[model samples]
Target: MKRKYNPHGLPPWLRSIRNVCGQFIVPICIFQGIRTLILPSILDVLLLFLLIAAVIAFQFEMI
Candidate 1:
């Protein structure tokens, strides 16, 4: 087995935020794909918020 390293060496908190955003976004995408009723009402809204927050965090380097 081989280990890979990131050259930028992101901090632990940034990694955590990225992981959390991925977790939230995946389920929302799956739900949207299924054409669920909640897609527009809830999942879409939640996904939008999560994406906004993730973008801001990355932009400001606050993660």
Candidate 2:
């Protein structure tokens, strides 16, 4: 059996939200990234950087 391609199965305009999220996330990530690097002695900063890295990695996987 063969499957048919279906765009309607997906929600409408999901790409717009993803685009906005990608745009906003990059700068915040960079700022936090630098801060984390500068303040490695503080555990909170490191954890925040880890979370951002995980998110960016997931975005890479999606792309």
Candidate 3:
């Protein structure tokens, strides 16, 4: 008998994390960009920086 092969190889947890990040981070970035264009405030800029840092951390599986 021959063994079957699976095409979808990524683990479930990793796939979920990727989906969540893609769904959440992309929208947050887009919204931040729009907000910055409309009104560039110091607080918003700081928050945007923090958000980008967080995304980078998540991408590296740090958080």
- Which residue pairs in candidate 1 have backbone atoms (N, alpha carbon, C) closer than 3 angstroms, thus clashing? none
- What lDDT is reached at residue 49 by model 1? 67
lDDT of each: 0.61, 0.66, 0.75
lDDT of 3 by residue, 1-52 (tens): 9755432466899678866875698579779978988999998898888888
Residue 26 lDDT (model 1): 50
* Candidate maximizing TM-score: 3
Superior by TM-score: candidate 2 or candidate 3: 3
Could you give candidate 1's per-residue lDDT for residues 1-63 as a string of tens digits? 975555258888878877677567555555554554444557666766666676666555554
User: Model 2 Cα displacement at 1 (Å)?
Assistant: 12
Candidate 3: what lDDT?
Answer: 0.75
Residue 49 in candidate 3, Cα distance off native in Å = 0.2
Tens-digit lDDT track for model 2 on 1-63? 976644345556865665666677777777777777786667768667676875775476442
Q: How do these models rank on lDDT, best leading? A: 3, 2, 1
Q: So what's the TM-score on candidate 1?
A: 0.39
* lDDT at position 48, candidate 2: 73
